[model samples]
Target: MSSAEDLQFKILQHPNPTSPEKRVELMANPTFGRVATDHMVMIRYTEGKGWHDAQVMPRGPLSLDPSAAVLHYAQEIFEGLKAFRTKDDGIAIFRPDANARRFRSSAERMAMPQLPESLFVRAVDELVKADRDWVPSGENASLYIRPFMFANDAFLGVKPASEYMFLVIAAPVGAYFSAGAVTVWVSETYTRAAPGGTGAAKCGGNYAASLLAQAEAKHHGCDQVVFLDAVHHRFVEEMGGMNIFFVFEDGSIRTPPLTGTILPGITRESLLTIAKEKGIKAHEEPYTIDQWLEDARSGRLTEVFACGTAAAVSPIGAVRTKDGEVKIGDGTGAGPVTASLKESLIAAQRGQANDHHHWVHRVL
Candidate 1:
């Protein structure tokens, strides 16, 4: 990774940017994915020429070929991280370097050119700085940044494209979901990924494949769908978008291991580290659906939650399966351990607590 000083950015201001007052109004009650900032970052890559033409410009549509590879072949990848207005009125992004490293890994897996980690972070910083006013400081809001790349080739071949476009767009978003504990549906019908697949890669195709399962979940009155292992369909893997954690009354927390079948979530890692500091035992091991059902029914399982970049942490109260329902800890709301860990994590992100691991990056 190159140092911050190695990356230089060219900025082009937007002529008709949103005014401060209107920007504030949008941020006041921003939905999760609707509104975006005025400017965005763009970079291009060619097969041999490598990455070039870094620019921060106004947000707009792109012109692509009728036979663009991404439109058909789906050679695309993306990443999500956030910029926050810290408790002290300073802007900080939580562990953007981790996101950058993961972005490179995803590109390598998708057979695309790697954007240098420093360059990725620099592009994100340039865009956020240009639209710094769009960063929301509302009660449960922040600036959500989405960085993505797609094959831009106009060829009709099955091979990797020769050209690609990388861009960063940001939006001011409120909480990912309601604050109450969520209900999830377990899908025995569809599997997210197998042992050797692109499950760990943050690519668009993976998500595209899960939409049907998500719709099935909604049909059952559940907010998300839980996927089982592709082999046995017994072991609990993850939710559609977030990682699942099982918390027991014994003060032990276990999440599914990274067996190349689950996305390695950054929030999942941070909680494990913080759990250890709080004297909570954390394990990355397998726990099957049968075991989960038995434990929750017997009161051995105290709380369950999901973690990701968008929501940080969400308490899982009840799970609806074809077998029946499994409620955790009276099925109320966030549990003690869940609440404590979330508070610590969010506080660290906002610079309210001591950043012992130095994860917060103040780009401004």
Candidate 2:
């Protein structure tokens, strides 16, 4: 943990905060990433001083030099976590320390200075505390936290920048899948990550590379896109933004093993822990799309789902390709396995079930 003096942040209040009526209207139909809160947390870094000049300021535009490193080289990393308003009207964040650790991992991968875990967590906590009123209390509604670091050095050289900036922004969001369960398109054409790549890192470049495939999925009338192993294109990797799982009728659940190609999802890890506690068989191994189709046809595969911070656990009803489409479950509804897992996971997050894993971190 960083010392309190070292992690000190300058606080600045918003001059023109949103009114209650307007904020309520926005939260009533808040889609993902559409609106932002009044304030943002920021900290700057230099080669000589490391991370410094932390502040919470009004949300506005950034004035950057023409030769800013992030603009030219795309050196940036980010993380996503949410703060929930519990039944008792207290606020808590789900697995924020996990996000802090992953943020450091992404910083290392991007060749940027790592924000101290304590500072990162404190930044989120302070911002959420100051903006607790921005947290929506409706069902499946909460405050979304986005912490990001980017190179800010103004130089034309194609090397790692000597200066960087870390910022945290918040938004009140409704459920990611407000429409319901989604059908994902298996992207046989575009691969999300290679064996030796930034797939494991939560960097902007990896997501930029996935947008084309995601756009194609939308064109094909699908909600999300799933990628295969870049080398063989035979094994399942993950969705564009989520980790995937397959459940067998015998009560065994399988997810793709971490081959240094898949992002180690916090939600996926939590699900594994909960599944084991419930005596469900959970296996992490390489299973190809063909095997999944075959198992589903033979009545062995009972449920297919995707997991991430944004969507939590969404049942994958069908996997579509140019050749054909394979439906994993009986109908458009979540399977028994998916339902149980989703219920337990959501219950733990919402404070409805005992948090034996101690995954929830209280913010306010």
Candidate 3:
């Protein structure tokens, strides 16, 4: 077993890093998660040994055993956040401490060993700082950072693996779902999570399960899929990739509550806070899909949007169901409240506006 004294990070400089000009060209229009940075952060974990051999090494393929427990049992979880080039030419991350807490919660849900909150944050900070240049400088451009943990023990039995690895990788990216308001397909046939499932966890399996539903959305010529609650199949839980928000003509806002069946997204929480500060009434109660359809159809619900790390604040132009489709706010590009909130959020993230919550962490 390794001691806490051995948890120090060993930094290794990449021998053949991408050139600055070429990197800039790549960042000009880099698709999400396709382009990688020069270096990454990795930490090893053994049940009795605790966490040891923390390193900042060159980004490359992982050499995992084919029989690794994560491969068979899917005992893995991940978190997503971004590093932005602030207005003062600095690099910062948004509310990573919140992400750390969520990561711990997910690790617990996945039955994997916990990576300390401090270690997780430090690993992310190290990688982002190492690849600071990858943080693009433009509207809607930033370095998307992903931190993940998985079982590393090469065993096939259905049990928790004693060996594990935590890694943080960065990629320069633009918008995740495209540039404008998106149309979502209501997934009545597929459910994202049950009452006591890992719906709250940011695990790969949850996403893997949603891919088919997402594919179905694409088949319907929709941009994303919105999932209903598992038990009743009534309430709006979240979009396949992000949290759903409903804005009313009365200027009130409501999002689905975190009832262990939906992800407690940091962006969703931030928007709620921002709405309150702006004097907009906001609530986190269960709102059904029928209610959404009725409100939109009756001119009560004025706008709908999805919030997350990748898509930021995206307006939902319309929703497609088995019955038909209805456009929100006359199928506009972006409504006033949506545009205002998105601008304010992005501005705060980029240091253009005040950091009310102190969520931004400066890395470089």
Candidate 4:
């Protein structure tokens, strides 16, 4: 990894840029993870050379060997964030430094070379500058950034790969769901994380393992799946790709604490900070499904929601099980607290409000 002062990224402009009309049409209703920008950022790392050849070039497919370690061993990790177009015709990223830190942690876990925070931020800045027009300013829309690292060594070995590639891609994404709030099902049959496992890391394998349970949730007429601990399947771990939170009627918010078995979500941490600043009671502790059901039935659990970079904050309608179902609140839509928190966070990201926390990083 290069030092902050020595960091430099070479730019290779794409010859064929997407037409303005087509880009506008796509941005009008840009769904999540669908359309992509014209360019991407890539950097390579090897055993002999630490990190080199940082470039921003045209977006395309990668040519990899059949025996690439990422293909066989699933040695890959990814980070998600967004670049929002502010009202002043400028763009800013939400907590990109935090994402960069988490990316380094993920790299350590996956045995991949960790890129310096300055380099990661610079890569994002360069790509966003090159594709600033792709960022959508429409309501609930922004340019999503995906930074990923993977093992690229072709040698067939059981140990970690000696070569790796780090890449960042951008996508113009709109709302995750067309509706106001989405309903999710509790996955009792599938466990997302175990004690002393890789749950804390945002790796591809964790998501790959939850696909089946997510499919089950979809089959059960739900938008997403909520997973539990692998040990007893009692404590709440997280949703398929988001963190879960429970709002109690006693004017307190509770979310499962970081037990080394849940992804330390950026949105989750941001919400906690906002809640504290707003004088909302917040607790980080374990709460079982049964307890949640009981509390909801007794009007103690006021609201349920999930948080992530993709879906800023989404209200969870109900939790269904084989025995019975627990419907939270009136199930009409988002609660007041959830709505307020979401608005504040979005405002900070979009540069619409005072960013007292200094969470937004200007990319251009």
- Which number leads on lDDT? 1
Superposing all C-alpha atoms, what RMSD in Å does each candidate have to the true structure? 1.8, 1.6, 1.2, 1.2
How far does residue 63 in candidate 3 sit from its true spot (Å)? 1.2
C-alpha lDDT of residue 264 in model 1: 94
Backbone clash pairs for candidate 4 read none
Q: Residue pairs in steric clash, candidate 1?
A: none
Taking the tens digit of each residue's C-alpha lDDT, what string does model 1 give over 1-364? 2333454567899999998888888888887889989999999887777787788999999999899999999999999999999767779999999999999999999999888898898899998899888887876778999999999999998999999999999999989989799999999999999987999999998898899999999999999999999999999999999999999989899999999989999999999999999999999999999999999999999999999999889999999998778898888799999999999999877877888798999987
lDDT of 3 by residue, 227-302 (tens): 9998899999998889989999988889999999899999999999888889989999999889999989999999
Q: Which pairs in model 3 have colliding backbones?
A: none
lDDT of 4 by residue, 214-314 (tens): 99989988889989788888888799999989998877899999988899999999999999998999999999988988998999899999999998999
Candidate 4: regions farther than 4 A off = 1-5
lDDT of 3 at 294: 92
For each candidate, how many residue pairs have backbone atoms clashing (under 3 Å)? 0, 0, 0, 0
lDDT of 1 at 163: 96
lDDT for model 2 comes to 0.88
TM-score for predicted model 1 compared with the true structure: 0.97
Cα lDDT, model 3, residue 312: 94
Identify the runs in model 3 with alpha carbons over 4 angstroms from their true place. Answer: 1-6
